[model samples]
Structures are given as C-alpha cells and as structure tokens.
Target: MFRRLEEGDPAVRTLWSQLVEISLQEMFGIFDRLGGVTLDYPKDGEAFYQPYLGEVIAEAKEQGVARQSDGALIIEVPGEETPLLLLKSNGTTTYATRDLAQVRYRAQTFHPAKILYCVANEQALHFRQYHAAARRLGFVPDSLELVHVKFGLMRGAEGKLSTRRGTSIFLQDVMDEAVRRAREVVEAKNPELSDREKTEIAEVVGIGALKYFDLSHDRRHDIVFDWDRMLSLKGDSAPYLQYSYVRAVQILAKVGTVNFPLDKWKGESGRFGVGLPEDVQRLVRELARFPLVLERAAADYTPHTIAQYLNDLAGQFSQFYECYPVLKAEGEDRAIRLAIVAGVANVLRRGLDLLGIKVLERM
Candidate 1:
C-alpha cells in the first residue's frame, strides 16, 4: 500500500500524503484527549516482507497448486467451486496474492498461536481463499490458526457512506460537529460555568459520546449514526454514564474527609451490623464482576462487552444513588455507603478508560 502510494505522481502523492497527515493528526488528537495511546509503525518489517510475494507465487506455480485460467494465474481452493485468482490477465497481482504472501510472512516471523484479521464481512471469501492457498502451498502450518473477525458496516442516515457519492464525512468534521453540539448543550445546562470550563467539558462529553456509541454496539451488526441519540443523556449513552460519575463525585464531596475502609468490606457480608440496602449490594456485586467482564471481552476481542457492562454498572450506581442518602446516614451506614460510592467511581473510571472514553469530573 505504501509503495503504491509512493509510486504515484509526485504532486498527487504529496497532496494525498498531506491529506492523510491532517486526518491522522485530528484522529490522534481526539484519541489523546480520550486518554488513548498510539502505536508505532513497524518500519523494518517492510524490507523483510516484500521479497515473499514473488517467492510465494513462484512456489505456488511450481507446485502445480497455481494454474493459468485464461491468461490469469489461479488457485482452486477446496470447498469452493470458483478458483481464487492470483494475477490478472494483464500480469498484475491481485489482493489475494499479496494476502497469501503476507500471511506466510507473518506465520514464519511471529509463529503466533493465532492470527486474527479484523475485517469487514464483505471480504470473507478473500480471507478464506488466502488462508486455504497458503496452507496448500505449505507456507502456513495446519496447527497455526488463521481467524477472521468480521465486523459490520457503519452507515449514515441515507445509506452507506461513500466517497464516490460525496457523502463520506471526514473525521475532522465529525469531531468538530460533535464538540460544537456538546458546547451548546453544556452552555444551556450550566450557564454559570466559565468559558474555559465549558469548553473542556464539552470536549470530554463530545468525544466520550462518540466513542461510547461506537463501542456499545455488537460489532457484527450494522450501526446507524445519529447525532441526537449519540449525545443523549437519558438512555445508555456516554452523557448518562458521565452524569452518574459526577453524582458519585458530588456525594463524596458532601462527606468531606470520610475515609473508605476497604478492609472492613472484604467479604460479602461486612462487619457493619446493619444489613446493606439491595441497591448498594447490587452496585458492589457489579463492581466485583469487572475483572471477569474485562477478561471475557479480551478473549472475544470485543470492546462492546466492556461497554455494555460499564453502562449496566452506571445504571446500577444511579439507582443506588437515588435510593440512598450517604451524607445523611449515621456512623457505619455512612461509611458503607461512601465506600460503595468510591468503588463505583473507581470502576466507572477504569471501564471508561478501557473503551478509550474520557470521564468528566464535573458535567
């Protein structure tokens, strides 16, 4: 991809590179604000991997696994009636050939237990053919797993967003629009806040709202982008979670110097003589399950599970906050309730961090 881009006309390539850099800068800025980190590109791997393309194709042809279909080179994969084309009739390489070489290079270099390709569902057959061809050519071992983690499309209001149709929205525009709408909401809700505070809050809310909306949905299902729904505070949205976090912070602030004795609440039934409220217990139980939720999400390679869990945790904490009065309660009761509130805040912050969403101290 980089080679093709670099091989284009100098003026066109420079313009394209500038546009890509601008998009990347905007994207990275948003990510940084949301407490996310960026990864470094593997620059040295290009030299090592580039030579495998021709080698793999030559081996395929030499082994009789790749044959000529008309003027194009093709491989007949098992369980599929149609042959996978490796090269065009014009003697140009196809994506399948490049993919087969890439996969073989990865397997030889990394020897990883599993190689997961997170791609759209539309390219399912392409990956299948690549995997099958690589195995048949002895480039990939049978023991090494090559899995495709297919995701669904993200559509706009009218239909699938396409650049050719001129309906494709740029990342900068989306971020700007979200922040702009968020500023309006913040201004209306908290008119007394200073400009700087409002701007900061708007940024956090806007970016968080956008990220939560994406991560909350099942990856295999198509999601429609709706501004009103994404920025909403009522339903299972980022604003709702932020509001819950703020409520917890407010409760903690009311009880000035109260200490949360986590040691006292080590077990399900703590030393507190009074029985805890059901809502408080529910919040505690949900907080306890965060580790399991994190593990499951990592195993399945789905951040939506973590997003869903955080939303549920936020809802549980909201109910507990509404039902119980922490500052007004006496002695052990107050301590227990404060501990629960602290736990909720901690879990909520950590969960949001996992989803690359920022938390607002005040919203």
Candidate 2:
C-alpha cells in the first residue's frame, strides 16, 4: 500500500529537509567565501500553498476565469492563443497554480509595491501568462508592478552547460579551479610573500575574477565561460581593478595621511582651484559620476553599468598616475594629486563591493 506524503512522515520529511539544508549550506559557504552579501531563502512556498490549492482553484472558477478543458483547469490569457493550465487531468496542480497562490500570499503577507522575478529568458511567455492570470483573477492589484528580469544562458566552449549533457560545471569545482589557477599566478608574481598571504590573495583574486566576469556583461547577452579573459590583469578584469586599487593604496601610504581642504577647493564650477592637471581633472570628474552610475545601474537592474564605470575609472587613474608625480610633488599639487588617488581608491572599493567583488590592499 502507498503511504500519504505528509510532514509527519519523519522518514521522508527529515531526509528531504536534511538534503535541502546541506545543499543550501554548501552554496552559501561558497558565496560567503567569495565576499558576496548573504541572503535568506524564502519560506517553502510549495508546502505552504499545497493545502490552499483547492481554494485558489475554486476562486478562479467562481470568477469565471478558470475552466475545465481537456481534463485540465485552464485560464484564457490575453494576447495568447493557448490558455494557461492550472491543474492537469490527474488532479495534480501545475506551476501556474503554485505561482498564482504565491502571488496572492505575497500580496497579503508583504503588500509589496513591486515584485521582480529573475529567471531565464525562455520563461518570458510563462511569466506574462502568469501575471495576466493573476491580475484577471484579482489576486494581484492593477497597480502592483510585476517585473520579469530575464537573463541569457551561460555557455561553455562546447555549448550550453547542461547536466544531462555532462557539460555542467559544479560551483565547488569552479571555485577550486579558480583558486588553483590564481595561486599559480600569485606564486609566480609574489613568491617572496608567505604561504598564508599567497593563499589569501589567491582566494580574493580568484573569486573576484569569477564575479567580475559574470557582472561585467549584459544580462540578456549569452556569455562564454573564459578563464584567460577573466583572470588576466591587463584587461577589463577584476585583477586590473584590484591592481589599480593597490597602486592607489601604495601612493597614499607613501604620501602619509592626506587632509584635503574642502573649502579651498570648492568653486562655482565645482572644479578644484588647486590648478589640477588635465588627467587629474579627468579622474575627478569620473569619480564624481559614481553616484549617478550607481543610480542608473539600480534603475536598469544591470550590474554591468557599474562594472563599466569601474573599468573606466581605473583606466583614467592609470593615465593620471603615469602622467603626474604624487610622492615627489610639493605643496598644493601633491595634496591635490594624493586626494584624487584617495578618491579613486574609495570609489573603486565601493563599486567593486556593489558588484560583489572583493578588493585587495596589495596585489
């Protein structure tokens, strides 16, 4: 005889909970090590909404939005030829049923003004139908904003990474490989450092590279997983930005503590009156644009905007560093240049942090 699946079934429930816990722990551990901000998983919607499925179906039917078609409960969605199936002939609820229930539950529980769903581009139609059905059934308010943030596929050199095709790369393996490769580079460049320092630097650089590569691209564009491009110090990669930050830190260290006179530098044009060099002026202008860039990134839901800004800022700083003298300069010129360096370092740190990439003091 078959047994009913219930929470009281200790044998199945305990094992399933343990499995989910273990997987979440592993994923969170890797993310934490990579300097990513921690996030809590939402409550188990599947279990919480199962009992209320009948109620949702009944409501849909009462509202004349859902009807039986070919042994399935379907809701006719606008602008679509096919109706959204809520329940199959076998009495099993579909994903639409769960999602509709989730929308209602969230609306009642949180009363959020907007909800964003980040899923693959392939699920565009499904979400459109789901949102339409939710609105038609009065589960979601007409004013409630629903955004679908669709991202493209991440493919390997062979093609799209798939578990069934045996081309999938595990997160742990990717992290380990990144660290291993980074360690090799670190040992070659900074062999004089202690083993511990090398290991720490490797971890920072490796994880930063991975994050930078992912965040530096437009989400809708498909990306190829490339190691050389990601780990390189010469291009618009994490190492390049880290190197720039380290250079700025080194300059600040040599110049001692800088006390920039805010009132003296203030002017009607917002430009410093310290007779700043053109390159220094350029760097300052770029630094000032950080806030606007961050705003745009948030509005667009694009981390790549920040990535591009950091890359440009780093490039400008590089130019300024090569063109000017910070340590040996005297009086106002030195102070102004040092202040610019400090600003660049601060902006770089903040930008990289927003992108979930770690910065290194010395690299």
Candidate 3:
C-alpha cells in the first residue's frame, strides 16, 4: 500500500483518498460520542506528510542520522536500542518517517513550545526513538517539549484487547449496553418520569459512568472493564457521582428555593464551616479544595485527580446527608444544610464537566 502510494499509482491514490476520508469521518463520529474530545487543534495525517517523506529520508542520510540497514533506512537513536525505521526495503515511508515530517512541519509552521502525543503506553519506545531522531536531525529545538502522555489499556476478562486478533470489544457496543442498563435503573428508580426524561437521563448516566470509571483510575495502571463495576451507583463510578449530584439537586428542589432562599446562605460557607455548623466539616473541607484540585490536575495532566477529588467530595456529601436533615431542620440550620448541598452540586457538576461527563438536573 505504501509502495503504491509512493509510486503515485492513480488507482491506489483514489482508493487511499476514499479510505482516509471515510476513516476520518468515522473517527470524528466516535470522538463526538466520547465527549470532551475535539479535533480543533491543527493536525495532519500520513497522507499530508507523504510528499515530504523522501525529502526527510534524504536529509536524514545527509545528516548521517539515518543509514541503510538490512535494505531499510533506520535511525539508531543514541541511548535507545530499537532503531526507528524511516523506510521499508521497498523504499516506502514508515509511520516514523511520516511522524518525523510532521514534527518538522509543525516546528517550522506553528513554532509550538511543546508537542504531546497522547498515545497508548505500548508506543513508548516509538516516541522515544522518533523524538530522539527529530532532535538529532534538528527538526526541533532542544527546548521544545516532546511529551508522551502514556495511559494504560482497558482489559477484558480474556486479557488485553487486540485489534489484530479481532479480540477487541467495540466501544459503541459497550456504550449501548451501559445506556440500556442505565435506562433499566431509571425505570426502576423513578418510574413516574417521562419517557423523554428517562432516555436523556440514561444517556447522561450511562456515558458518564463509563467515562468516570476510566478517568477515576490512576492513568499508569490497567483497569478491568466490568459492567457491574462501571455502572455501580454506590461505588466510585460516574453514576455514583451523577447520582450524588442529582440527589443534591433533588434536595434543593424539594425544599423549593423560594422557601429556603439558597441565595441567603450564599457566601456563608465560612460561617457554616467545620465546628461552627457541626457535622458539616467534611463536605465543607472537600468543597474548599475544588480550586486547588483544578490547578493541581492541570499542572500534572491528570484528570483522575479531579475524578478522585469528586469521588471523595461526593462521599463526604453522602456522610453529611446522612448526618444532617436538610428538609427536617428549621431556620438557620436548614439554610446552612441547603447551602452545603448547593456548593456540592456546583462542584460536582463542574468537576464532572471537566472530565467530559454530562450532568443531569435529576436522575
């Protein structure tokens, strides 16, 4: 395929163009479903860099960074054992060569301070080699940050999924199943809800559950995908967070903002904090950490940090809920409880949004 493309076969070009267009459409469709993902950033595929492949190979050879080894062009990056292949024996460009071209193109065009590859952990070696080669070839300056944001895979009961072996589970299928299961929960828990409400809420809960399960884990460790675990309402899942958020919404709604005046208690968190308002300490403390959590998560590139913080915040709210009686309490006490609920609802909604999970007013 690469050889035919490099040779400029008319038939191959037509088919390749059609395939790339279709594949991109399909890929963007999946990204839409995943949420919190966007392709607005400048990007170019292998086809865009194909024309420069030979130029890159020639330059590599001229710079003495690449050599013909076993009838192929390879770059043996210093301190790395596995050499990066620039061309196959057929003189067709490799993925590494295309990537190197992209590096050069972006470096000259955008002058970006950093280039990050959010690829699977298995490609660690490839990034190391290509990045080293890019630097050696002077494609990028030494100060330009080339980062590999590696994350673990989702394993099934059989073990790690493999697309080559046809053992990979379709993400759409998993999503559909989660939504179906979420619908069932909605029906059982709130049968009186409208049909439209049920469907919308299920989608929010189901997709949220899946996202939460993945993001809640430490990015470096692998996670086992289980329907029960992913959708659990009482556990550290998206549904649990969503449910807690909705529960707070429900409490606020039941009291009716007019009756309790949530606005009156606003900004009174300091007055109602810790020992001042009694048992509200945990929730107040967690709520206070929201800003710091955002800063830390951004600095570390760890979404799970937000996930874990939301999880703990939800748990603290759960404890506060059991200990305090929002609806039963009167006057100052009731307003304080409602204020805490309001604070939790806000943070949970915002934090979940940060993770690309949708929120529901009630579910």
For this target, which candidate reaches the highest TM-score against the unseen true structure? 2
Residues 1-363, model 1: lDDT tens digits: 444542456776677668777867776775675566775744323333545667877999899999988999999989988889987787667778778878887788889889888898888888888788888999888889888988887899888988999888876688789989999999999999999999999988988888898889888878898999889888688888888888888888876655545556456555332245555656666777789999999888888998889889888777777888788889877778888888888888888888888788788
Using lDDT as the measure, the top candidate is 2
Better of 1 and 3 by lDDT: 3
- Candidate 2, residue 322: CA error in Å? 1.0
Candidate 2: lDDT over CA atoms? 0.85
Worst 10-residue lDDT window, candidate 1: 41-50
TM-score of each: 0.86, 0.92, 0.91
Q: How many clashing pairs in candidate 3?
A: 0
Cα lDDT computed for each candidate against the true fold? 0.80, 0.85, 0.84
Task: Report clash pairs, candidate 3.
Answer: none
Residue-wise C-alpha lDDT for candidate 2, range 1-363, written one tens digit per residue: 012233246777677678778877887787678765667546453667867777889999998999999898999998999889998887777788888988898898889999999998988989999999999989988878999998988899878999999889987889899989999989998999999999999999998998899889999888999999989988699989999999999888876776544446556877743356566666777777789999999998999999999999999888888888888889867778888888888899999999888888887
lDDT of 3 by residue, 83-157 (tens): 899888987777899899999999999899988788888889999999989999999998799999889999988
Off by over 4 Å in 2: 1-15, 42-45, 259-275
Candidate 2 minimal-lDDT segment of 10 residues: 1-10
Provide the lDDT at 10 for model 1. 74
Off by over 4 Å in 1: 1-37, 43-49, 254-274
Give the Cα RMSD of candidate 1: 3.7
**Any runs in candidate 3 off by more than 4 Å, and if so which?**
41-44, 254-274, 277-279
